[model samples]
Target: MEMNIIETINRFPDQSSCIAYLEGLRWQNEPECPYCKSKRSSKRHETYRHQCHGCNRSYSVLVGTIFESTKLPLTQWFLAISLILNAKKGLSARQLSRDLGVNRKTGWYLQMRIRKAMQEGEDVSLFKGIVEIDETYIGGKKANHSKKKRQARRDNKLQITGYQDKQPVIGLLERDGRIRLQVVDKAHGVTIKPIIEKTVSKDATIVTDGFGGYAGLSKIFREHQVLNKDKEQYARGKYHTNTIEGFWTLLKRGIYGQYHKISARYLQSYLDEFTFKYNHRDNRLIFDVLINKIAAVT
Candidate 1:
């Protein structure tokens, strides 16, 4: 069911209720041992724990999930997930700490674990139909840097250009379907072509900007349409990259306005979080979907 903050609070008022909800989702009323994969288990009536007869080990409903080692209550985890799923620009760690009454470090760690669950594995079907592909850079504008840093850049000591130092993000959006995003070192044809060839079907039409990097796409795709953005030519009837371009706008806005700064090392996790949210925008039960994803991970 679709849930709001009040509904979530009313439904899971305490730790036991939260544990029961998660157990129902994970085991369908039949508890199983995560350690030994045993169906023979007995719940301790006094506590939220199950004992496996096979392994003789005690486990909670949180076992084998992202919340496994978490010391916080399940209610807090559910509340965190609710805030994250509902926030369009994303909830910052500091804001989450204030809202959840947890220490900043605990809030940061919670969000990171949730982001880890947000990652979509590569088991999805290949994209078909007309697909729009594009690449963008993620970094602060050169003008935003200090004068000394800009001077160092001008002297060629620091690489501050769009094609250098900045993190490159490539996106492919299938019309009326899902999107795929990746962080690449370079957007050269050698790097981009293989990803397209592997993730997209050869029978699908490809739409991209007039970049030399996509010059060889015609040989692989059924139809390759290029929008000459440099010449102010955007669309040719059914040929345009505006859809994927719009996605880049949202991504950049969220990164700049919310995150402010993101390290290249963990940028992919941020991408995963955004992509998961975008792909599930229409889902009414997104909170449950995230919990199900965490359950399926192990």
Candidate 2:
């Protein structure tokens, strides 16, 4: 069945139904023992247990998968994955906990596990052609009590520092293709250069805003085009960081509107979820893709 939250609940009403779904996706009829990778197995008992004849070991289909040691019902996990994947912006742990009837920490943990599957490393594939690169900050305002406190102050107060209490995130997006995002410690030539070198192809033309951090990018790539936002110049011909900036809008809306706030610790996971969704925007089998990715994590 096509998996929505309702469909997940209705289709997988029990643990066995959920297990069947997992087995269908992972094993495809031939159940294998995860410990020994032996296909000789039988459905001997409950919890989808399989007796491996080759290894003489008993294991469930969930073994080594994300649902291996789960205390919650597999139904809930399927629903959560469905909800998280379908949400265009993102889903909050708090809201997810309420929906799943679990504790906030459990909901957060569930999200982290799914995000791990969605994660794409720098080695996935290189961006080619006119790739747009940009750096943005993620965080709330700083506190007024003390300069060191880092607490967000009043909304109307004049800002002393431009990027106080914020984390720097760099993005490299291929024109009408995939995007790679990273949470960097800083946005400077030394920090940004290495990332660009690894993620983008040297033959591709790079487009970005006139940020000092991108100082030496021209020397590395075939061409580095700059859009001076400071001078009211944004795009000319095929030269603009608009595509990436447009992606930033979806990301920011997801962060600010859906999540409201995110910590530096788990920010990368949020980025992973967003990047995965954005990259596969046109994929009709997105739900299945997410499920496959989750299975691959094993």
Candidate 3:
């Protein structure tokens, strides 16, 4: 079962409990040397570190994982992980800092480290079985809708072209299964088609709104379903893109509501976080699922 905030705190009340949890999950028998991958190791006296006989080195369960080099206590790290995983709309770094009694900088670093583990590989398996594809533009909150901000941006010569001001993000969701999200330079066929081809399988049927970018998809995939909203024909049979659109609503609420502002440089990482949570929303052990993911990440 997923661990709630209180349960998470109770489970790892101290640093030693957190270390023991990691040790049990990372190794079944004796602790293995991360450097040499050998099980020949002994616990250091009065310390969590272990001595490896194979490489003549010392290590801990935190070695090479997301917790590596972190100065924060293991209990706090575990609590942060639990908080992040439990936040459906996402918990901001400032809020985390306030919650954990840490400064904003440390909270930001902690979040960024955890987010790094959420990244998805580009070569992950294709999405089959009725896929829904869509694109949306994300950016700051209308430049705060303030004339002063707008004037400042204009004085600095910032982009004012409505959609151009925002970053284009494409989402391809496999109906009731997994979803893939990517930030792209354009919503045109040139940039989007390649992503569709690589991320989606040829056998899967594709559904999308009436976007010119997806015009060529009919030829590449086995079947393409389009809902020409221009004619107000939405859901002609099962061709609607409602599923992915609903997902967009959630993502936008999280980014625009929870985060408020996200730099384009790190936009994809934010996408990865949303994707991870969405993909595992159904799992009863979602907290444990994220923990396992953290265990595998370096």
Candidate 4:
């Protein structure tokens, strides 16, 4: 679908049109009973609800999806989904509040629910190709309460410790195909090595920077190369981590520029959201693809 598809969707301002659209997506052949999965079902008082002939249970098209329990108009829900996927840097709850013309709390709740839908599954296969690995720290402002005392007072400030305080992000870029990102536990060898084994194929070439953690991954990867930035070697012949470095640039921009400061607890969801967008950059209908995920089961 094109951007104009959203305009057409806008024409359907009523709930009936929204229900029909959702029905088409939820069921391809016939409107089967969501409860019993029976083809024999009857409409309830011309409403969206349907009754199963076998078990006599009633169900709406949204019973099993993320749309369950939401009271907003289906049209507004679709509009919100489209706006979210169309925006490049991602949207905040306050921004959605103003745009959707809903109360700030409602918008916040809606965005959080949508974020839940964006989360990637754990059992999904890891990325494979010339995968590049890296990590970064994310934390909010530091208080300058007492700017007294000697010896570089800035150094005395409490640095956030553990992967819990600072988000441990690892990115795997598959040459030109797709990028897989995860919030790791730590930057240590034990934490990072297992991820490398899972994501990259044994025959794939792996590129990373000079980190002691990634030292031994060369044995597993077909050709592992390191670009020691301190030694002034960012690239050696065809070996470099620039591709993943470029991804880090986009991620930091989204974090610092757009969202400002995402809490460590919810950092992974945000990373998955960005990674989903990055991997599908080439798809012209990315908005549609992501919206489908909301309807998709785990």
Global Cα RMSD, each model: 1.9, 3.6, 2.3, 3.7
> Top model by TM-score, which number?
1
Instruction: Report the C-alpha lDDT of model 1 over 1-298, residue by residue, as the tens digit.
Output: 3477887899889998888778888888788888888999888889988889999999987877889988898899998988888878777888889999999999988989999999878888889999999999998777788897788877987666555657988899999888889999888888988888878989999999988989988988899999888899999998888888888888888888878989999899889989889889889988889988887636
Tens-digit lDDT string for candidate 4 (213-254): 888887877888888899899888867778888778777877
Per-model TM against the reference: 0.94, 0.89, 0.92, 0.86
Model 2: residues with Cα > 4 Å off, grouped in runs: 1-3, 143-160
What's the CA RMSD of model 1 in angstroms? 1.9
Measured by TM-score, how close is model 4 to the native structure?
0.86
> After superposing candidate 3, which stretches have Cα over 4 Å from the reference?
141-159
Model 3 accuracy (lDDT, Cα): 0.86
The lDDT values for all models are: 0.86, 0.84, 0.86, 0.73
Which residue pairs overlap in candidate 1's backbone? none
Residue-level lDDT tens digits of model 2 in 181-216: 999988888888898899999999999888998888
- Winner on TM-score (1 vs 3): 1
Show where candidate 4 strays beyond 4 Å.
1-12, 122-126, 141-165
